[model samples]
Target: MEPIVILTLLAAMIILLLILGAPFKSFKWIGTGAVRLLIGALFLFFLNTFGGIFEYHLPINLFTASVSGFLGVPGIVALIFLDMMVVN
Candidate 1:
């Protein structure tokens, strides 16, 4: 399948999750809006490189560490997933 198609599907899935409000509570610490997204992207990047792949893959410290004081998880998840798709 084309990369674009895969991306579209991924986007659709994320949107569906948002609409369904599935376990978003875990992400509440992320705060609200674009700032959260920006941080998530930075976090996702540093997480893998600075902390290593295992660290990034695991959630032991991700929730507390990534949230950075407070909004939503989608922005973070979106940033991470978007970078993953684009980078790899």
Candidate 2:
């Protein structure tokens, strides 16, 4: 019932589902996008502090948003990776 316990359980479930390649939809592309969206939203909302503690905001900001608008999804991925590594 604790938040940490719930998060651990959810994370474990996702790991299991991914490893098993459990298809969530009949469509492959849609299913993959749905999974990524769910996982990203979960982490972004709950774990923003993990990135924030280091003043490491994802390039989801103004500058990168412009780049993202031009470069699309790959740009966002680069932003995410940069944010993740900023603290390390």
Candidate 3:
């Protein structure tokens, strides 16, 4: 599909949702979650990069990203602990 067509469709969807009075608070949470997810993914990427010196690394994937995004710091710790357990 063309870019213009896609954008038009998106705009129409937004207009329709607005006319229907869609709850925007949920959208706010979704946006926030997306931002947090990106941050979490980047955090894991950097951790593995610098951690190479300490012989530490964490696999960055959808599962890890979602976990860290939803659970924040504790999720990363959990992944580390799980990695250690599996390795040992």
Where model 2 places Cα greater than 4 Å from the true spot, the runs are: 22-25, 46-88
Question: Candidate 2 — which pairs collide?
Answer: none
Clashes of each: 5, 0, 0
Tens-digit lDDT track of model 1 for 1-88: 7645644664565465456543476664432332344344444444555557454542324453345314445545564575568666
Model 3, 36-79: lDDT tens digits are: 66666766866787789999978878788778867888998898
The candidate that wins on lDDT is 3
| Candidate 3 off by > 4 Å | 1-23
lDDT for each residue of candidate 2 in 1-88, tens digit (9 for 90 to 100): 6757756875776676577663554666654544564455445435345767866555233455444544556755666777568744
Off by over 4 Å in 1: 23-88
Per-model TM against the reference: 0.28, 0.38, 0.63
Better of 1 and 2 by lDDT: 2
Q: After superposition, how far is residue 38 of candidate 2 from its true place, in Å?
A: 3.1
Cα-based RMSD of the predictions, in order? Answer: 11.6, 8.1, 9.1
